[model samples]
Target: MAKTIQCTVVTPERKALDQTVDFVVLPLYDGEIGIAPDHAPLIGRLGYGEMRLRRGAEVSRFYVDGGFVQVVGNHITVLTAQAVPADDIDREAAQQQLDAARGQPASTDEQRQIRDRTVAQARGRLRVARQAHP
Candidate 1:
């Protein structure tokens, strides 16, 4: 049997997930990072993308936006602004958000940055959902 580690995912509204997972892939600010049992302790800023957790043959996916991850001992905790399961994501709604973000005109740098982040988050949700289906 594969070894497992404690994994917890939380958002401002609620606790999204808490379980023992054999492996996990997180979306870091720079890129993706994979962790397993006994991984070195660390902390990192997260980005907009899919967070994948696996146990045996089953895989779970979530879309996370702008968070922080902490790894200590054999436990992994993710604190995110938002987290949505891939199966719960609405493709049409995500597409609409992406379109709206792209269509909006940004008058200032702050507006542009927010718009860009919104677009990225919407795209990430769509991507995760599509990947799960396809």
Candidate 2:
């Protein structure tokens, strides 16, 4: 049997997941990271991308918005603004959101920041949806 670790994912609205898994892979601000049993203690800033959890031969994927992650004593805790099942993401809707964000007026610095964040989020959702469907 494969060894596992406890993992919890939380958003402001609710707890997204609480399970034991064989392994995990999540996007960091700079890149992706894989966690296994006995992972070192650390904290990281998460990026907008996929969070994959593996249990035996089964793998589940989710689209996670920017947040933070912590690993300590064979447990992982994820605190994110948003988390959605990859299969639930709508490619068409994500694309439309990206387009809308692109068309948004970014004349001001604050507007530009919002537009950029929206664009990134929409793109991340679209990417996950495409991967799930493909």
Candidate 3:
């Protein structure tokens, strides 16, 4: 049998996941990184993308806006600024948000920041849903 490690994903609103998995693949600020059982302890900053968990034949995915990840022993903990399980995302709503954000006229720096965040959120949602169902 394959060995697994504990993985917990938390966002400001709630703890989205707490499970055991053979490995985890996360989108770090720099790039994608994989974590496995007994992985060396480390910490990393995450970016907008999908977190993929693999255990046996089952695989799950989630979207994270940005966060930090800590790995120690046989456990990985993710503290995210924002996160959503793929199943919880509404594709139509995400698309609408993306469209609305894009349609807004360029203005102040605050508007740019909002646009950027909205785009990132939409991308993360798309990434998670694609990976989860594909």
Candidate 4:
């Protein structure tokens, strides 16, 4: 049998997931990172992308926005601003959001930042949805 580690994903609104999995892949601020049982203890800032968890032959996926991740003692905790399961994502709606974000005019730096973040999130959602469907 494959080894497993506890993984918990939380958002401001609610707890997204809590389970034991054979492996986990997170979207770090710099890039993607994979974790498994006995992984080195560490902390990292998360980026907007898909977070995938695997257990045996089953794979679970979530679109995660900005957050932080911590790993210690065979446990991984993810605290994100937002998270949506791949099955729950609406590709058309996500595409609309991406288009809106792209078309919106950013008058200020803050507005630009927000717009960029929104675009990234919508893109992530679309990517995850496509992967789920295909």
Residues 1-134, candidate 3, lDDT per residue (tens digit)? 76789999888888888999998999998899999898999999998888889988887878888889999899899999876778887777777777877777659998888888778777777767666556
Cα lDDT of model 4 by residue, 49-119, tens digit? 89999998899999998799999988999999888898988888888988998987789999999888888
Considering lDDT, which of the candidate structures 2 and 3 is the better prediction for this target? 2
The TM-score leader among the candidates is 2
Q: On residues 15-124, what C-alpha lDDT tens digit does candidate 1 reach at each position?
A: 98999999999999899999999999999999898999999899999999879999998899999998888898878887888898898788999999988888888888
lDDT of 2: 0.93
How many times do residue backbones clash in model 1?
0
Task: Give the least accurate 10-residue stretch of model 2, judged by summed lDDT.
Answer: 117-126
**Candidate 2 residue lDDT tens string, 69-111:** 9999889999999999998998888889889989999999999
Q: Which has the greatest lDDT?
A: 2
Task: State the C-alpha lDDT per candidate.
Answer: 0.90, 0.93, 0.84, 0.90
> Model 4 Cα displacement at 63 (Å)?
0.7
* Best of the two (3, 4) by TM-score: 4
53 Cα displacement, candidate 1 (Å): 0.6
Candidate 1 deviant stretches above 4 angstroms: none
Backbone clash count, each prediction separately = 0, 0, 0, 0
